[model samples]
Target: KAEVDTSALQNEAIQLSSASGHADVVKLLLKNPRVDPSEKHNFAIRRASMKGYVEVVKILLDDERVDPSVLNNNAILLASRYGHAEVVKILLTDSRVDPSADNNEAMLWAVENDHSGVLKVLLGDSRVDPSEQNNYAIRRASELGYVECVKMLLQNSRVDPSCRSNNAIKHASENGHVEIVKILLNDPRVDPSACTNYAIRHASENGHVKVVKILLQDSRVDPSVRDNYALRHASKNGHADVVKILLEDSRVD
Candidate 1:
């Protein structure tokens, strides 16, 4: 006969078992009336989700006693951050889970970590707003050179590439992500000249020859916009290629 130890020890064991992906043990522990699955600030579920333990999360969610949205929707956020696409999908199906909670932090983590699968899942959720948090998702993805993630975010009609969310183009150009720069420019909504020449200046300072050339080629981007800032930065950084390219632009003073 199995004796029920309804004490604090039982709860700890449940958490440990859940975190370790012991789905069977978690199911057994949840059956006990004295054991609390959501105890300890939802630690068990968060750990399981963070580690991509889909079965463990499923078991916890089935218990009805477990709450996925508590603690700032941490389960979804952690799962997205770790690229647990399946886990994220499961959580999104629950009505209690808010995909846009905490200012859509889940999306932010997904974009920043380049979790393309997780991002795709989030985008499918009608409640998720890709442009939330001041378009932080695309900006961060662009800056980090997460090409796939940026592409996914851009596909969402709700996202305005030209919204000027912290000047994503500038960040992309500054980080020397040439392909990303081209993608953003293709959107037509994004103004290559929006950042007062910071985009070109940053690319020039960082010696990004390809990025500077691309910016110069855009008719909308005036090469001389920032009082020759780009030229000075290229010369100061000793980027002979960038300097040459900028000097070739008749607009650069």
Candidate 2:
């Protein structure tokens, strides 16, 4: 017979079982009507989800008494941050789960952690807004040179390719992500002169010669714009190769 204990005992057992990924123990404890799923800072499901205990998560979700929506700093958010794709998938099935909740903060967490697997799951959900302003996902991905993540986010129809906040192109250029720069530049909506022509300036300052050349190829980019900030940055940073390239542009005053 399953032992039904007091609230405190049940809470402790549930927390330990969930944290340890003890699916069997969790199942047994959850069967008790006295066991509170929301106990212990609402960590029961969050811990299981974070650790990628798919079976445990399924068990918890299946219980009619369990409030799957208990965010507890976002169970899905924690799952995504830790790169638990399976766990994230389970959470998405809950109708109350908000992919864009907390200002789409979960997606930002996934991007910052470079958890593309979890990101993919999150992006697939129509509910997840890809264009949250200054959310570090795209910016961080571009800066760190995560080509696939950038591509995925771009393909999502909801995401604006030329979001100025944490500008993707500028971050890519600043971090010397040549391929990413090319990708963003190819997007017709993206403005090379956006962010006060920071794209070119970043490429120049970082000595990303390849990226600089790519940006210049875009006819819309006036290298001499912003008092030739790109040129100045290249010179100041001692990026001789970038400076050489800039000098060749007739637009440079």
Candidate 3:
């Protein structure tokens, strides 16, 4: 009968620690000689650490049975994704922790979610590669107009400006980010004309006349590129003024 009650208490302590990050409860449970600190529960120290409960995490780490090396990459990954900077710092300091591990997927998650604070930590850790793109962090930031994040990524020497599925320039241009477009254009590695035609078509089709005009100004941009859709789009979208500009270019009869 006593054994059953102790078991129930241990389970409850684990639950409480997982949810509340209350170190007091955990310490009380640890006092029970029968309670196994190392016993794997659905919620463990890793969850507490990810939640930024520094005190509870410290208690769990002090337990001889508790393994600091436990790979809760998913939980740590979530913490980083949500901008839990302190939690990430604790996790990364463990010698067993692999900052560059998981094929850069964690960094990708942070980037895609616009967790700029987490991204700074990840990017600063030389272990993390900036070009890893399963999450398309840089391009996604540009597309969503997260200008500060985009700027940070671009400033990183390791980040490949052109390394993307759609290319940052095209994404910025098509999304009507004139500022981002200008930034990408200034990079020597970015081919001003790389996706100009496609961007022009998309901008015109979407009635983003200002974007079209910006692209046209690029000396590399071929205004004569036969983009029937652009003309058709301008006509359909009631951008007659833009249509007039295209008509005057002498590219369309």
Candidate 4:
């Protein structure tokens, strides 16, 4: 039978040390004969990884007793989600670590949180699928107005440049991300007509005159399409600048 009292104390000490990011405490505690570092769960490593404790993580990972492959509460996922780029890099060195594990949730979390530093590391790895159609990192970055993130994802050949199902251009326009709008507009694959009048309408409705001007410059975008949707939205929303720009198109009825 396990020494219940000793085991409880060890577990509590390790967890606290890991959570507090005390590398010295973790090392000293691991030296205790009664402490079972070999526990399959490896709670210490997980906590250290999640908290971005680089030294603590390294110490825990070096222990042969700690298993990095345990599926539940994945260390890499947590580290990536929290934007711990250094911790993630350290974890990736272990053959046991699967950065792409957990259905690419690590990458998705990195994208969602705008962890650009972590994202660079993740994108360079062959294991990360930047173009996972279902996850759509590009779409998420575009919608969130992460221009740099979007640019990085676009470099991956797998990612579709066109504003497809995720409405990359539409969301960027709606949120008035002018730079992102410019980038998407410059992509040949992106059809301005793809979102119907969504791009101009949302830009107008939100009173984004600059974005409306950028869209107007795109010869592919017909401002008067959808029964003059841009004009109606700009007029109704009291966006005089956007309305004036739309009316100048000469196609507004």
Whole-model Cα lDDT of every candidate shown, in order: 0.87, 0.81, 0.69, 0.82
Candidate 1: lDDT over CA atoms? 0.87
The parts of candidate 2 lying over 4 Å away from their true place are 1-10, 31-34, 134-140
Q: TM-score for every candidate vs. truth? A: 0.91, 0.85, 0.80, 0.92
Q: Report the number of clashing residue pairs per model.
A: 0, 1, 0, 0
Please identify model 4 stretches exceeding 4 Å from their true place.
Answer: 1-6, 38-40, 163-166
lDDT of 4 by residue, 10-84 (tens): 478777888799999889888876776545477778878889999999998878888766764388888989999
Query: lDDT (0-100) at residue 5 of candidate 2?
Result: 65
Clashing pairs in 1: none
Q: Let me know the TM-score candidate 2 reaches against the reference structure.
A: 0.85
What is the descending TM-score order? 4, 1, 2, 3
Worst 10 residues of 1 by lDDT: 2-11
On lDDT, the stronger of 1 and 4 is 1
TM-score of 4: 0.92
TM-score result, candidate 1? 0.91
lDDT of 3 by residue, 1-253 (tens): 4354544655665656655877788888777777666555435665775676877766776677766555646546767776787777766775655666677766877777878888888887888886775336677777776776788888887776666434777777777887777777777776645654666666766777777777777777655566566677778988876687777665654
**Model 3: CA > 4 A from native:** 1-12, 31-33, 49-52, 68-72, 164-166, 240-253
Instruction: Give the distance in Å from residue 186's predicted Cα in candidate 2 to where it truly belongs.
Output: 1.5
